[model samples]
Target: MTRIEQTFITLKQQNKKALIPYIMAGDPNPSVTVDLMHKLVAHGADIIEVGLPFSDPMADGQVIATAGERALAGGTSTRQAIEMVKQFRQTDQNTPVLVMGYLNPIEIIGYENFANLCSEAGVDGILMVDLPPNEADDFPKKLQHYTPCPMNQIFLLSPTTAFDRRQSVIDNASGFIYYVSVKGVTGSNALDTDDVSTHLKAIKANTDIPVCVGFGIRDGVSAKALSAVADGVIVGSELVRHFGDDSIDTKTAIDNILAKMDELRRAIDG
Candidate 1:
């Protein structure tokens, strides 16, 4: 099994939820990104979503957009990010690393080269936020080696999506399913557990694959809530806010968020 698949199975057997954390590559600094990655894993992150720096990020909020821009400015190209995965693999091959980003960077790098590079780096899978399966004709072939998982957005205006559609998405996703808990973009408010439960349980009814919920997950309470229902939880923007380069209290802020995330993972696992 793939690293991503094994991690989820391990958590499932333990009767615990997975804690996945995302941080933009080359943010704060290129060197610091890897350091923070290991620190997070040491703390309790089962899956690490390495944000590949992009020029324009649509699905992201202001916080992540800024982080991406900074990483781009720091010269965090697709190659650099992939190298980070290679370095990460050298030490901890157990934790799955998923490259999360826009299509522009990979487009510039050439999809064939990007996929080969990711496979060589031991990357488990990818979650291209803007790349939908309907439009899979354009890039799916190029990313064949790198498994793609569609993010499921539970919304009100759309009412709900049919099972056939979600099952198709799950089939496309080789690693696992990314269940977007809310309708809007990232960095929103806390999701109501009832809304999340209804939607996720519906998803669970369709497939046996692991489901990881993301977006607007702020603290221990929020993480614990999502973990209680879903197979796992993903935190990104909140972690970005922790690495505040502009703030005088950057180190302390990062330490605080890291500590809380660790504690939250313990709460879920223990």
Candidate 2:
């Protein structure tokens, strides 16, 4: 099984939910990516979603958009992002690492080559925001060439997903499914737990695969409420905000980030 798959299974066994945190690669600066990644694992992150710096990110809100821009401006390339993951693997061999970003950079390197690079970098999965399951027919074949073992081809499910499309996603998807809790871009809105629970119930009825809620989960209260229904909660903007502005010392920023992670962790596990 892939590390992601194993993680969910293990969490299920322990009756504990997963805490997945998202951060932009090279954000704030390129020098801190690896250290921050390690810090994430240290602070109870079950899985880490590392965003590849992209020039154009349609689904991202201003917060994540700015983070990506910072990474790009700092000379963080796709290769450099993968290198950060490789360095992270030196100490962390268990926590699953997922690359979350647009497809442009991966296509530039060729699909097969990108899969190989991810494997070499110890990455366990990918969530390409713009790539739909139907359009990714050839990707699995290419991925198999490099990854003989299972690797998550994670997909997104939103409130607007039709029955057929939802089935298609569940049929094609591996690992846990990412359910966007809100209709808008990341960091643009707040979550309604009742609505989230209703939607999550419908999704759980369709597939046995674990469901994870993201995009509007920003704090302990929201994370805990969502985790009661879903297998995991993904915190993006809120965690990214902990890094603060350039003026904040890197050490202080990191401490704040870890403190937030620990807070969310306790909420989920409580």
Candidate 3:
């Protein structure tokens, strides 16, 4: 089984749901990225979704957009993002780290070469927000060229997705499928629990793999409500908000983030 699959299985055995958090790789500063990753695992994150800091992140809101701008201004590159994962793997061999971003960078590096580099760097999964399954016809085949495919090519599904399109994504997606709870960008308004539950029911009916819900999930209450219905919750803007405060140091930011994560961890486990 993939590391992500094993992580979910282990969580299922414990009667606990996964709490996956997202952060831009070089936000605040590139030097602190690996340390922040360790802190996430230390707190309670089951999987860490690290953003690749693209020039334009269409799916992200202002908070994340600002974080990406900070990262880029600090000279963060795709290679450095992979190296962060390599450094993270030094002490952590189990926690799954999924790199998320747009497709332009992947194409620039050449997909096969990028896969090889990720394999060498010990990355566990990747989520290209803009690369729908239709355009990624050969993505998995290319990834297989590596002796042992080092990453799961995760895909996104939204509330408006038709049944057939949902089925298409579920069939093609590995690791777990990311369900965008809201129809908009990250860090939007409050989530409607009843509406999300209905969507979760439909998605779970179609796929055996874990389905993680993201977008508009902000606090422990919302996290708990969603976790009760879905296999996991991927929180981005709420966590990224802490990192954007220039008034605080990176360690202070991470400590605060972990405290928030602790709340989420408790909520999901409850």
What is the C-alpha local distance difference test score of each model?
Answer: 0.74, 0.88, 0.87
Clashes of 2: 0
Query: Residue-wise lDDT of candidate 3 within 1-270, one digit each (tens)?
Result: 567878989999998889999999899889989988998898999999999988889999999999999999999999899899989988998999889988899899988788888878878787898888877887854553454535688989998888788888988888899999988899988578889899889888877889999999888999999999999999999999988888998778888898999999999888
Question: In each prediction, how many residue pairs overlap at the backbone (N, C-alpha, C within less than 3 A)?
Answer: 0, 0, 0
Error of 2 at 153 (Å): 0.8
TM-score of each: 0.88, 0.96, 0.96
Of candidate 1, the 10-residue stretch with the lowest lDDT total is 150-159
Which pairs in model 2 have colliding backbones? none
Off by over 4 Å in 3: 141-145
The C-alpha local distance difference test score for the whole of candidate 3 amounts to 0.87
Candidates ranked by lDDT, best first? 2, 3, 1
Compared with the true structure, the alpha-carbon lDDT of candidate 1 equals: 0.74
Question: Tens digit of lDDT per residue, candidate 2, span 43-85?
Answer: 9999999999999999899899989988888899998998999
The residue ranges of model 1 lying beyond 4 angstroms of the native Cα positions read: 137-164
What is the alpha-carbon RMSD of candidate 3 to the true structure?
Answer: 1.4
